[model samples]
Target: MSSPVTPSLTYRSPPGPLHATLLAGTVPLFLGALLSDIAYYNSYQIQWSNFASWLIAGGLLFCGLALVFALVNLVRAPKKAGRPLVYFLLLLVMFVLGLVNAFEHAKDGWAVMPAGLVLSVVVTLLACVTAWMGLNLRSGGPA
Candidate 1:
């Protein structure tokens, strides 16, 4: 009689509690940071440039925290487990873009606001994707 085949194992390990926490926390943390910055701008004589700075700072902080978590998890994982270095590099790229966008927003008028908005969206999406990858990587097995 024929039998069903099972998948083979590789150098992957299931994500642990820390992975779960980091994965789930990243989005909310970013959103909260962004919202806080927005709310801070509600005062009189609001300076969008300042708001941009706060937003950039918030995004960078989130990325930094996420990178640290990924590094720690990767170190603890089995040698066969895939490294999350790509995510780390991507986060760094987002950080640089965020800084650039912040500078654009600091310029007079809203001429570059559209570009800044696009950068913000991209950064947020990247953060989510990176976190999701971390969450799933926890259950890794041999390639």
Candidate 2:
């Protein structure tokens, strides 16, 4: 009689869950930044609602924390961690650019006061998710 077929398992697991979580976090954080920017279009003050700014600020905080957490765990991980690290570096660049842009906004009399900041926060969120995905998948996999 032929032997029953058995599926083979590998040293690593699929990264679907981590991918989903990254997407989940990214959507909200990006949307929060976009929405906050849209709200600023309401009037000439170019100011944002305290609540909205706070939300974006929170997103930034969460993203920073997530990146740190991910990097710490990436020691045991494989090549997947490379992409996430790139994302984190990109995020830092975006943040620094945004800060510089803030000064430009002050001089240019732009209608949106925090336009640069909002975009920076969005990038941060995306980077965070990428980092999380890399860390969770590879870290938990076979070393």
Candidate 3:
């Protein structure tokens, strides 16, 4: 009697070290910005807004590099149908919103409070979600 052969499974590779590092870096910078925004909202201190602006810039730099890597991976991936696509799109949204948040932070005085705070919250949440998904989800298929 012939024995049945087991099927081979192939799983999507995780992001490279640089990509992973960039993704990881976004969270803290954005979170710091959010915290700074909150402090500014409560304390009315101009310095807090300055801190938030700088943090948001740093987050943008890291996120933009990660976005480029995601795009390259999506293009190179054998099958472009699932998590990679979602990750790219989500990262794109996060970057755009982060840019908007940066613009909001550029405003002077009390004008930066409510809108800046709102944008910071949204961008920070997006950063967390993208970072989690980018690191954890693996797309699998036949070899």
Candidate 4:
């Protein structure tokens, strides 16, 4: 009787393009939430009670979902790991910081926050723009 042959046990690498784009998609989505946090970081002087919390919470939820989806696709098909990974990591940090601000805001009731309200506008805008661009890339042609 003849012996059966076996395939190579080494792991093969997939094309990098797919992972690149997946990373790219994470950007705009993360920004969507991050930007919202910035917009509402400190409305206490503006004296809008709980408004920042509401906006940030909602934004985070949406962005978080989008980020997860993007990451998942990258994992499943790493060819999409574009620049969005860097952007996503940065935005993720901003989001965490925003949440911290939210906690502080709750105690102080919008007392300019430790970092002040400016963070809200800047971060929020950046997040929005980045997330938008990232998502837009996903629907484009030619990878």
Candidate 5:
């Protein structure tokens, strides 16, 4: 009987401590933003309030903080990592969407809310993908 052959695969560890922390931290913030939005819309009618304002502000602040972490890692790392770069870009896009959402709320434009919701979902998904990539990053250490 012929012995079965096994396929070999190389394992790669995640990024260093700082990068890993930043990436791990971002995922919860993204989920929080999504959940906050969902909770706000579900419980309240179509009207703005201090609570809604603060909820959004907090979410954006978290995203911004996470972005800073990613950006610092991108700049300080010996070699530029593509995942951090992509994470930075996604954060920027999410920030733009946040601006649009804020403007739409301020303008009392109910019609644009659907677009805002869709954008939020997209941003959340992208954030997840970015975090996943960050989690898979090979630690830039001596091999």
Candidate 6:
């Protein structure tokens, strides 16, 4: 009598180094932008707003690249019913919000405040969530 055969399992590969780097880069840049926005709100310094704008631009660049990578992974994934899809969606939302935040930051003077600060907060949180999901979640299944 032979022992029962076990089925093979397939696991989703973790993100490549470049993708991981891009995801990791977004969080700090967005967080820095939020901090700068808060500083500008409190101190009314134009320089702080400039800093926030630059930081938001960097965050958007990194996020857009990461979103592309996530999209590619989602497409290439053999099974897309779980974390991969969710990860891609989260990244998509983060990128869109970041873009909006960047546009808000582009406004001049008092117009940049309030809305810019609020958008910075929202975009930062979304970046954190997307980075966490992209880095931690792995989808797997039977081959």
Tens-digit lDDT track of model 6 for 1-143: 99999876658578999999999999999999999999999999899999999999999899989989998998998788688888888888888888888888888887997999888888888888888878876778531
lDDT winner, 1 or 6: 6
For model 1 the local lDDT of residue 140 reads: 49
CA deviation > 4 Å runs, candidate 5: 1-44, 47-53, 139-143
Which is superior by TM-score, 3 or 5? 3
Per-residue error (Å), model 6, residue 9:
4.4
Which RMSD does model 4 reach against the true structure? 10.6
Q: Write the per-residue lDDT of candidate 3 for residues 1-143, one digit (tens) a residue.
A: 99999876667579999999999999999999999999998898899999999999999999999999999988888778778888899899999999999999999988997999999999999999999989975665532
User: Residue 4 lDDT in model 1?
Assistant: 91
Clashes of 3: 0
The TM-scores of all predictions, comma-separated, are 0.59, 0.50, 0.92, 0.54, 0.59, 0.90
Off by over 4 Å in 6: 1-10, 141-143
- Segments in model 4 whose C-alpha atoms lie over 4 Å from true places: 1-47, 113-116, 138-143
Which scores higher on TM-score, 2 or 4? 4
Clash tally for model 2: 0
lDDT of 2 at 64: 51
Of candidate 1, the 10-residue stretch with the lowest lDDT total is 36-45
RMSD vs true structure, all candidates: 4.8, 6.1, 2.4, 10.6, 6.0, 2.7
**lDDT score for candidate 3 against the true structure:** 0.92
Of the two candidates 2 and 5, the one with more favorable lDDT, higher being better, is 5
- Score each candidate by Cα lDDT: 0.57, 0.48, 0.92, 0.49, 0.57, 0.88
The alpha-carbon deviation from the true structure for residue 40 of candidate 4, after best TM-score superposition, in angstroms, is 9.5
Per-residue alpha-carbon lDDT of model 4 for 1-143, expressed as tens digits?
A: 99999854433333245433443443443344334435545332333435555555555555555556555545654344444454456456656765665554465544645453554555566565655455444411233
lDDT of 1 by residue, 25-115 (tens): 6566455434434443343224644555565666666556656766665566545234355555665676676567567656655454556
Kindly list the per-residue Cα lDDT of model 5 for residues 20-66, writing each as its tens digit: 66555655654655565565466555443233444445556655666
